[model samples]
Target chain A: MALKVIDTIYIEEEIKEHPRTIDISSKFKDARVLTIGKFGELFNKKSQSFRLQKRNPALILAKKAGRCVLPAPKGFGIGGHKNYYFSHMYNCLYDCSYCFLQGLYASADYVVFVNYEDFLEEIIEKSEENPSSVKTFFSGYDCDSLAFDKITGFAQYFLPRLRKIENCEFELRTKSINIEVLKSMEPIKNCIIAFSLSPDEVAKTLDKKAPNIKRRLDAMKNLTDQGWNVGLRFDPLIYSEDWDIMYSKLFDKCFEIIDNNMIHSVSFGPLRFPKAMYKKIKIDSPREKLFIGPFEMNNGTVAYKNDLEKQMSDFCQDQLSRKIGKEKIFHCVSDVV
Target chain B: MEYSYSIRFVVALEAEAEPIIEDYGLKRIHEINLFKVYRNNLANYWLIVSGIGSINAATASIFLYQYSNANKSSFWFNIGIAGYFTGPAGEIFLVDKILDEVTCQTHFPRSALTKKIKRDELLTVSKPREPLSTSHLIDMEGFSFFDVVNRFAVRELITVLKVVSDFPSYGYTKITKNIARNLISNILPDLREFVAEAEEISHKELIRLRNPASYNEVISKTEFTQTQSKILEKLVRDWEEVFPERYLIKEIDGLKKSSEILRKLSSDLNNFRIDWL
Candidate 1:
C-alpha cells in the first residue's frame, strides 16, 4: 500500500544543515519540508495514532544527541556479556503481525537519525571499555538491518566502518532479501548476517509487505555461498493448524541449500505480547484473528495458554535437535536475564 | 455486509463541489435528507455537498454513510476552501492536522497515497476570523469533517484537501463561487490520482472481508447478539483465511443443534494445531 513517498518531512532544525539531512532532502525534492525543535516532540507525543499513521507515514530526520549506544536487553543477545544495540533508525519497512514494534511506539513513521557517525563513535567507546576481547552489538533490533538498504544504505555505510573496529562483533538481524549491498562487498568475519524466518504459510499470511519465504531462503543460500556467516532466526513461532510439520518443512528447505557448517546460530522464540500492548492491538485491529485467540495472561504478559505454549516451544526444539546440534540452538525468553 | 463503494467526497459549499462533480462526470443520483448526493459508480466515487459549518459537515457525512450503508473500506474526503495566514490565494494543502476551536480538540488526517502537494495544520473556527497562527490554515468545517469521518473509518482513509481562497494578502471580497470552483478544478487531476489509489486499497480490504452466503447463514444460526454478531463475523473471516480448505460439515461428522455446532466448531478449530502453517 505504501511507496517511497515521505512527501512531508519533519527535519530537526539542528540537523537541517547537516550533510546527511541535505543528502536525504535532495532525494525527495517534491516533499514538503517542515522544521521542529527535536524529534521527540513529534515522536513521543501521546495524541498520535499508530494504525492510522502507518498508512501514509512521513519521514522524520533528526540528529542523535547524548548516548548513542546502550546495553542490549538481557535476553536480547546470544552468548555475550557485553551486548549492546543502537538504532540508527526506528521502525521497519516490513509489517509483521507479531512484531513488538507495533505496541512499543505510538507512531509508525520511520524515524531515521541522520547522525550515524555519533552512534559508531559511541560503539567504539563502549567496545574499548573491554579492549582485546570480543563484544557484540546488534543493529536492526529497532529497525530491519537491510530492508530499506536501497534508500537508507545502512549496511553499505556501516559495514566498511565497522571493519575498522575489529574487536567488536556486529549482527545485522533482518527479514529482508535485499543483499545487493552485502553481495557487492567482501564478507566480514565478525559480522553475522542473521535472517529472520517463519514457515511459508505464516510468512505469506502474517508477514505482510515482507519478501516471500522462498525469496528469503534463496537470498540466504546466495549469501552463505559467498562464505558469509549466516544466522537463522525462527523467532516468534506462529501457531496454526499443522504448525509442527510446517516448520519442519521450512527447516528442511533451509538446510537443503544452506550449509550446516556455515550456519553461525539458530534461535526460536514463542509468540507473546505485553498485557497493555495486547489490549491496544486488539482494540486497533478487532478483526485480527491472531489477537482473537485463546490467550492467557501470564505475569502481566498475554500469550498462548501454558499447554499450547509448551507444545509450540517443545515441538520447535525437537525439530531443530534432529537437524542441528544443541550448541548453536537458542530459545529467547524474557526470563533469561 | 455488501458495501464495495469508493471515495466519498464531503464538501461544505456547493460551488466547491460543482467543479469536482463536473470534472469527475458525477451524476445527481439521489438526495440524502436535504443534501444533494452525486455518484459515479464506474469510478466508485460519491460526493455530498454539506451546506456549511461543522454540524452540517458532520451531519452530511453521517447521512451519506447511513444512506449508502458504507463500510470501513469507503474513504471520506473533505475538499473545500480555507483562509491561510500566509501563502498565495491559489495554494493547495492536505490537512495533516485539524483543530476544533470550540471543543479544543485536534485531529490529524493520515494518507498512504502519494501526491505532489503540500500539507499543513488547519483550524476550524466559528466565524470568518483572522488567522492567529502563521503556518496553520483557518476553515469553517474541516475539524468536524475529520472528526466525524474518522468515526466511520480508519484515520488513514480520511483526507482533507483545502484550497487557499482568502489569505491575508488577498481580501475576503476576492472570494467568489466562480473562484472557489476554479481553485478546486485546478487540483482535480492530482485529486483523481489520489482517489484512485484509495479505491485500490478499499478493494483489497473488502476482498478479505467478503464472505460467502453459507458462512453468514452459519453465523446467523449461532443467534449471537448484536455485539456478538460483529465479533463472530471477524472470527469467521479469520477462520476462513487460515483454513480455507476446511469445511464445517465435512470435518465434524455428527454435529446437530446450534449449541453443538458452536461447541464443535470452536473446539476443533481452536484445539487443533495448524501444522501445515
Candidate 2:
C-alpha cells in the first residue's frame, strides 16, 4: 500500500462520454491526484499542444467520443487465419527499455478511457459486418489487455459479450501476473488467453517492470486449471550471449505447467522494428542496447541480420515443432512487405 | 441527491501481490516503480487492485476517484480480504476506522452516508506481523487506502471490508498461496452492491468546490497581488520563449515529420496524459 508515488490529482469533463468508461479505473487504490480536464480527449490535438513536464506522478483524464472501436490490424491473426485487433487503452504501466510505447508516446502518464460498452458494441457489430463463419477479435494490441483488469473490468464486461457472439473468438494478450478477471467467470470456449513469454534472464534484464517467469508460470497453471485456451507468444526473441541454453530451459519450464494440447497455438518472431521507430526510440533513450543489436534496415524495417534471424527462427521452429506438432506452431515473419 | 456507486478495494501483499492477482482479475496494464495498473469487476461494480503497500493503495484510490466518474450517489468501498485478531474464519468485517499505526494518525470513514454494517477496529501497520499486533487486523495497504479516498472528499464513500481467512494472523504463506478464485468469488458480489450504495451516499455529501469568477474576484483574493500574477505570467512567457511547442514542432517537424510520421508520433505522445497515473 505504500507505493512511492511521485504525485496525485483529479480531472473533470468529457471522459464521461466514453462507453467503456465504466471500467477504466480499479488499479490505483491510492494514487497521486493530478489534473483532470475534458479538453485532452483528441489524441492528435493533444499532441500538438504537448509539453514534457516532470511531475511526481499524476493520472490525467480526457473524454473521447466516436470511432470508439477499430478493426484489428491486418496480418495480426493466429491459428486458422481470420484476425482483427483492437485496444481500449493506450500505453502501459511498465517502463521496459525495449517497449515500443517509449518511442510511441511522448508522455509517460497513464490514460484509461472509461468506455467498454462501445468496444463490445463495435466488436458485435464488426463481427456481424464481417459475415465470416470464423473470425477472431484481438485485444491488448496497444496495451496489455489484462494488465489493467482491476481498472477496466475488460473481461467482466467483454467475456459475456463474446459468449453471445457465436462466431467471434476473442484473444487477450498480456505479460501480467493478474488473471482473476478470467477466474471470476466461466472460461469462454472461443476465448484464448495468450501470454507473452521471455526467458528468465531476458525478462530479468530487459523485460524491466514485468513479473518474473515463476509468477507468470504460476498464473498460467491457474488459467489452464480453469480450462482457458492458452497461447504462448515468444516474440521478438532477444539474442543474448546464452540464448540457446536459456530458451531450452524456458521451453522446459513452460511445458511443466502447460499441456501442449491445451495450448491453442504458439507463435514467435525476431526482434524487428520500423526503421523510423527505431530511430525515434534511440533518440528518446539513446542508451538502449536493443537498438545496437546486430540489426540492418531491410525495406523500411530494422531487423537482425538475415542469417541470424533465419538461424534463430529455424532453431525455435525446430525445437517448438518437436515439442508441439508443426500445425500448432506458427512463425510470424518479419520480412512481410 | 444520489450519485453513482464506485467500490474501491485495497489488498496488501504480505509476501508479494502476484499470487492474488489472478483472483482479482488484474492484468498489469502498465508498470511504474511503485505501482502497476490492474482492472476487474465483480457483478456490476468495477474493482481496481493496486501494487503492494500504502502509497500504492493511496495512489490507486486517488486514481479510482478521478477515474470513477461517480455521481452524487456513487459509493466507494475498499473491498479486499484482510487479517483479524479474533474474528472467525470466513467472517467479514466493515472497518469503522483505519488507524495508521506508523504515524499514529487515524482516518474514519463517515458512517452516516453508509449503510450500517458489522463494524470493527482495524489497525494498519507498515509491515504484517503475527499474534495480531493486539489491534484488530494487521495489514500494510490500508492507511493509503484511507488517505486517497479521503482526498476525493468522499470519505463516507470509502469503506474497508475484509474477509478473515487467517489468524495470529493469516500466515504470509497461506494468505499468498491459498487465497484465489474460490475465496474471492464468494465475497465479491455482495460487497460490490454494498460499495455501490455507499459511494452514492458519500457523493451526495461531497462539497463541490466553486469555480473562481472574473478578474475582479481573482484580484480580491488575498494571497497573490496583481504584481505577482504579472511577474509569474512574465516568467512563464520567458520560459515559453526558450522552449516553445510550436517552435520545436516546426524545427523537428520537417526532419521528423516526413509524411506525417512525427505528427502521428507526436499525437501519440501529446495524447499522453498523466491523469490516470
Candidate 3:
C-alpha cells in the first residue's frame, strides 16, 4: 500500500499559523516541515529537475496575494459566455507524459494556495457583476482537481461555497478515480464533473500513475448515475495506428455506463503544446517515446501536422456523435468561445 | 569475468579508506601525492583518498570522475569522520543536510536514500572547534564535496556518510589516524549495505543506457533541432531497449534525409510496448 508522506512541507511564513495550514499539517504528521518567506522563493528557482523531483516532491502551502481569478484561455470551458479559471494548486500528482504542467514549472513540488475564500470572493464578485449571464470556473488546468483531493480536500471545503453563487458554474476536470468526497456529499448540479479520457493503449504508454481508463469510466458512471452533470474531455488526443478503432471502443465503453442525458457536454481536440512547453518537455523527458513521435510547429505550437490533426479530431467527433446528441458535443478551438 | 565498477567513494584520508580498502580487497591503482585510487576488478568498485579540506575534496572528486569517465548511474560518495556536539564515537549517520560555514550556504542531499542508517545534518567548517556552535554534525568537506559532484552526477546517486569521531566528552586531540581507521572498520557491514543498494540502482539504469553508442553514427549524421535532438535520443534508446539485438545503424545507412531517419525510427517505435522491459 502507498503512504501519504510528503517528503517535506515548505510552509509560507505569512500563513504558517493559518487554520488551513494547520489542517494540511495534520494530514502528514511525519513529513519534514520547513518554513519559507514565500512559495516562489524556492518554487520558481531554476535548475531543479521536474522528472527527478516528481519521485519525491514536497508540498508548499502559501497565500496568493494577487489575481485570485483570471480569465481562461479562449474556448477552454464549455457552455459559458464568460469563463475564468483559478488554481488553488499548481503541479500534479500524476506523471502523465503528455501533461503540459511538466514543462510549466522548474520544480515538481505542489504549491497549493491555501487562500480559498479569496478565490471564492473574486468568483462571487465576477458572477454578481452580471447576475443574468452564467460563467464557468475551470479547475485542473495545472493540477488534477480530484487526484489531490485526498490531500487538499479542496472539494470538501469549497464545494459547498460554490453552491452559494447561483450564476457561477464549476468544472472539476481530472483523470483521478478518487471521488470519495463527491460520493459522500449530495451531487452538485451546477458543478460539472469532467473526466479526461484516452484510449487504454494510449493511456498505458503516456499516463503514468493516473488511474486506468476503466476505473475513470467507472467513477464517471457512478457520478452521472447519481444525477451529477458529467463532461467528457478528449482534448489533446493521441494518434496511433488503430486510433479510430481504439477511440470507437472507448466511446462505446463510456456510453455503456453513462446516461446520455447526464453528460452535459463532450469536447475533443488534437495533441498540441506551446513551442516553449514542447521544448522544455523534450529536455525533461528525453527518453519518453511520446516526445519521439513526429510533430510539426504551427503558429508557435508543436503538434501533429494539419492533415493528421483534422483526421484525428474528425474521427473522434464522428465516433462520439453517433451515440450522443449533436448539441452535447463541442470542439475546443481558439475561437469557439 | 571483468567487472565494471559503478560505486565510488572519496574519503579525506587513507586511514578513512583503510578498513574499507582492505576488506573489499581493493588494490591500489593510481596515486599522486596524498590522492590515491583503489579498485577491485571483480567487484567493480573504485575508492579514492583525497587529503583533507573542501578544496581537496572537490578536486579529488573531479579527478576521479574524469579519470574514470563516470556515467549518470555512477554513485559518488564522500565518507569520513565527523564530530557532533553529542553523539558518541562510531555512531553512523547519513548527512541529509549540509551547511557550509565559510560560504554560509546550505545544500540538501536527496533524502530518498535508504533509511537503514540514522540521518542527520552536517555543518562544514573551516577549522576544528573546542565546542560545537549548532546541533548539526561538523565536518570539513561535505558541502564542497556535494557542490562539485552534483554537477556531473545525479543528486540521488551522490551522498555523504559520516561516523562520529569526537564530541565534547572526547575532544579532537584524543583522536588519531589509527582511532579514525578503527571506528570506520567497525561499521563496514552497514556501509556495505548502502553500497549494495546504490549498486542495485545503478545496475537498473545500465539496462537502459547500455551500448547507446551503437547508434552514435546515425545520430551524429543528422542535424536535428534541440527538441528533435532530444526526441531522437529517446527513439534510439527505446529501440535499443526493446530490441537490443537488432541494429539501428545498419537500418539508417540507406536513409538520406533527417526526416526519413526520424520517421523510420518513430514508425518502428510506435509498435513498442512502453512497459516491455
DockQ of 1: 0.26
Error of 2 at A306 (Å): 1.7
lDDT of 1 by residue, A84-122 (tens): 888998888878887878888878888899888898889
Q: Tell me what fraction of the real C-alpha contacts between chains A and B each candidate also makes.
A: 0.40, 0.00, 0.11
Candidate 1 lDDT, tens digit per residue, B177-270? Answer: 9998888888888788888877787776565446633466676554566665654555555565556677754643465455565566566556
Better of 2 and 3 by lDDT: 3
Per-residue lDDT tens digits of candidate 3, residues B144-216? 9998888887566787999999898889888899999999998898888888777776675454345355555
Instruction: For residues A278-329, write the lDDT of model 2, one tens digit per residue.
Output: 7666544433445555566788988877887898889899888878888878
TM-score for each candidate, following the candidate numbering: 0.75, 0.51, 0.86
DockQ for all candidate structures vs. native? 0.26, 0.01, 0.22
Note the Cα lDDT for every prediction shown.
0.78, 0.59, 0.80
For candidate 3, give the lDDT.
Answer: 0.80
TM-score of chain B of each: 0.82, 0.56, 0.82
Choose the strongest candidate by lDDT.
3
Interface CA RMSD of each prediction in angstroms: 4.5, 17.6, 5.0
Best by DockQ: 1
TM-score result, candidate 1: 0.75
